[model samples]
Target: MRWARAIHHLEALAQECAVMATRPASIFPVRVVELWAVGDVLGPLRDIDAVTVALAVDLPVEEVPWLGQPRGAQQWANATRLDRNPIVGLWRSVHAPVWNHRVERPALVWDAENGVAEKTLAALHDGAGERVRLPAPGAEEWRARLTEELAVSVRALRDCTAAYEQRRWSPGKLEPVADALWRASEGYLDVLDALHGPPEPT
Candidate 1:
């Protein structure tokens, strides 16, 4: 629950910082990826009690202080603490193919790419940590994975909505609904619409 809380906070901060980024050099570029992104799309997650979000950026560590209050607060927290620098360590961890493409706005792209990658990565690893080849994103296996993910999101939304209608609202319980709405905007809607049309008037 702490992890989810932390992620929710970070997401809020990110949205705020992104707004400020309209001014030139107001906020530096920050790439938020991995578990936190996945969590945003399908979370208030289970298992994995201890978790930390990942960020990527190129800047001198000393220049971080110039980033003023709340603009780079999370980054400051991560970099200042000796033990909280996972992103820094990741730079040295191992190599993965770097994606090469024109990003329209590098600072403001959050999409279902993270969700798609999460499914792909899960398919690529067995419970025992053995390697497996993942199905291509448009392939049958990958479609199946996305379908299942959508179903989970839909079910979660329905449950939360029903509970809210019954006046049973609770903090954090509706997070899945939020995730569903967000992921839908992030491209899950197109995927589902292509595969099965709009959800039958739930």
Candidate 2:
């Protein structure tokens, strides 16, 4: 496949660079990272087309079933660190492409056969949201995983690029969403640099 070939070529290039390097080798990051974007609580997502837009923008997104009968929702987010610069993640969502487009919308979020449903999402609620089943592993764990408010803002910006892809944006209209995401990546990358520990003393 094309992707496989691309990876192979990249790996070859890295190997050669490592072999013939005069300068010391720092971390070589080629990992693919996807973004997370959620539109609203208005309705659940039934279409991957929206997600497709996210992917086309060089980031993969997941659909979580939240509103409108659990068709589309915002679910857990997990990004694994790959050698300090690259991270890879898998998104769990409320929709699947296993069936036709029609069936795709309003995707199922549960195993009907066993009558098991997700409790973190769409469950009995208590005032103040103090108690609820959030798909995130656990409350403490989720909090530990979250970077900051700015990171969330940036994630939303990554989701908003769909308008440009759909031929819907006009000069008359503002593009704050797109603008914000660009800025967010800049800040997030900074954090990456700090934690990565200063370019191997060179």
Sliding window of 10 residues with minimal summed lDDT for model 2? 65-74
Q: Estimated TM-score per prediction?
A: 0.26, 0.21
Query: After superposition, which runs of candidate 2 have C-alpha atoms over 4 Å from their true positions?
Result: 1-110, 116-140, 148-153, 161-202
Candidate 2 per-residue lDDT over residues 1-202, each given as its tens digit: 2322322322332333233222222322212122221121113322212211011111222221111111111111111111222212122221322111111112122231322223312321111111331232354433333333224334544554454445445655555444434544554454344333336665
Error of 2 at 170 (Å): 5.5
Query: Worst lDDT window (10 residues) for model 1?
Result: 97-106
Which model scores highest in lDDT?
1
lDDT of each: 0.33, 0.26
lDDT of 2 at 157: 41
Instruction: State the local distance difference test value for candidate 2.
Output: 0.26
* Candidate 1 Cα deviation (angstroms), residue 71: 23
